[model samples]
Target: MKKLAVVNGKIIDVEKGSILQKNLFIEDGKIVEVSEKEPDNSWEILDASDCYVAPGIFDMHVHLRDPGYEYKEDINTGLRAAVEGGVTRVAAMPNTNPVNDNISVTEYMIEKAEALFLAELYPIAAITMGQKGETLTEMGLLAEAGAVGFSDDGLPVENAEVMRRALEYASLFDKPIIAHEEDKNLSGDGVINEGRISTLMGLPGIPSTAEEAMIARDVLLAGYTGGKLHICHVSTKGSVEIIRWAKKRGIPVTAEAAIHHLTLTEEDLYKAGYNTNFKMNPPLRTEEDIDALYKGLADGTIDAIVTDHAPHSKSDKEVEFDKAPFGIIGLQTLLPLSLRLWKENILTLPELFKKLAYNPARILNIPGGSIKVGEPAYITVFNMEKYTFTEGMILSKSKNSPFIGWKLEGKKKFIIVKDKVL
Candidate 1:
């Protein structure tokens, strides 16, 4: 690999929550120097003028529907989407065809990602066998096979006993049980948030209690069992309060808020006139919920921001709103959408990258969340610029995002993943 230099950029120092004007030099896939001096003629140059150079983004919660659901998204296209979105490390949910419940499936995902050499993929194995919520899977064996964590993401673990066991078992391997918190009984056939909109539309509504109740239960379980608990896609004001309370008590809990939940509201969904692309599990809530989520991120109650990145084929999302699958492709829009936080002053640039990169790395115990000498050169260079997001710009096989054709800020100029630049 040729030595490369990134020059004339403002480097975000996430560790210190500051930015510095500096240049970086890389060789043999690792950062060889961080200094003010420019590299000589022998080095290849990447001009980063008028851009922010930050650690590579790590999206901890994403659904890469490989294995049996390649029609929706495969590893190849999924990772491609990831890199384009400036994400260099991704932790994929274990909701594939076979559910990623065993060693073979776990090994296959890891091997496939290694071969692709795009954004580093970390497989999160399922907490229960086939996600049935009855029996636990082989967490020990799966961890040995390179599974970073365990989750039954698309399906919530309804049984408290089962959930408690999963938390405890995952703790033994020093891994987190990433929970999809929802009380199915409360959520019951609901297509959107429970409020005026649901009543006016004459559709069943999913009350905030459905999510808050489960988060409450799981956090207490984590406290009792001394296990690591990570709540996924927290969507309610009540849920944020619960996570904040849990963190105050130091109950071994962490949580993430999805980009859509943080930015969009049920009002947007209603205005979209039943567009299935706006549909997602734990559905979009109100502006009140969005405000609470922003506070959660600002105060460290929410540790990371994720896309969920659930991709379904065009045919899969063309059905009636309630009948269609819940999810929208988000990989290609993660960075630009997330920059809204920084632009709005909810978080500074360094603080934003901490959630986007540093915190996720710490949660999953993975690498590539920081830039420093002697570390692998995983970096992203981007600028805040307005651009219209078009369907044609989507690199993922799926085209289900609601943000297409929307004017958005933040564009990734390029990403350096080890020795290769994309």
Candidate 2:
């Protein structure tokens, strides 16, 4: 294979929290060297003098509504969106039409990703059959067929006994049960956060207790079963405290926070005139919750940052706030929105990269989140001050994002994954 060299970029060492100017050399899909000296002229060159080079992003939660809902997003389009956002890998949630509860569906996703060969796609199988909250799926079989983890995302596994059994079963395979923690009863008909904002708009609210209550139960169950539990899209301050306590007690638990939750708040909903694009499950929370999330992220209470990139068509998002479906597409907006953390000094550059790249790879037990010799060539290059984001810049099939028209601080320049530059 021909050798590739990336020259003059600021290489971020997330593990060590440092940044240094270095040139990288790659051959046969693995990095061969990273040094201050320029590489030989025989190697092909990719200039990065104006950008920062880091590990390609790995998003642990995404919704690629393929098979059943292509109009929203399919693997082909969704993976492209991921690549466009400098993401080299993503863990797709199993909430498709046939509900990925079996081996066949799991294999299909793997096979499809292999065929496309853009960004790496890891499948997360459904926890229960049909996601009905009744019987558990074939965990062993699903894992054997390439499922990275299990979750019934978009729908919480409400039955306590079922969730307990699922946790126990998943523990046998050393896999995590990605809990979409929420008490449906408490969140019933709620469109946004349960607080002054919801009341002022005369809309029903989804209490923070709904999320914290379920997290409290699952953390206990995970401790009792000794299972690896990963909580998804953590939005409440109370939930963060529970996870910190669980970690302190040495219970195997990890949690993630979405970029939207970190940057925007419930005040954005009113500012947007109750636009559906600002509406999402676990809705944009309050400033207090956002503050706590930042603290959790900084202190290691939150393990990773994810997009939860739920795509919806124009018709799906054009309805009234109460009638429209939850979620806004996020794959393309993750980096720019996340850059706000570094821009505001909430997190240092390396610290932000840890949440975006290293932690997600560790949580999913995947390869390719480091810039080291002999490591796979998964790199993302970006210029922090050169670009701006707009609605027209979205590459996804859907354009339902609150960040549209906002001037973002960073721009992705190149994505190199497994010897291929995209």
Regions more than 4 Å wrong, model 1: none
> Which parts of model 2 have CA positions greater than 4 angstroms off?
none
TM for every model, in the order presented, reads 0.98, 0.98
lDDT at 401 for candidate 1? 94
How displaced is residue 88 in candidate 1, in Å? 0.9
lDDT at residue 6 of model 1 (Cα atoms): 94
Over 1-422, each residue of candidate 2 has an lDDT whose tens digit, in order, gives: 87889999999888878899999888978999999878778898999988999988988999999768889989999999999898988999999989999999889888998799799899999999999999999999998898989999978999899999999999898789998899999999999999989989988999999999999999999999998899999999999999999999999999999999998999999888879999999899999999999999999999889999999999999988899989988898898888888988889989998889888877777677888887888898998774657778888888889888787778788888878888
Identify the candidate with maximal lDDT: 1
Candidate 1 lDDT, 1-422, residue by residue in tens: 67999999999988888899999899978998988997899899999999999999889999899898999899999999999888888899999988899999999999998898898889999999999998999999999999999999978999999999899889999999999999999999999999978987777899999999999999999999999999999999999999999999989999999999988999998889889998999899998999999999999999999999999998999988889999888887889989988889999989899999889988987666777788788898999889999999998999999998899999888899888888
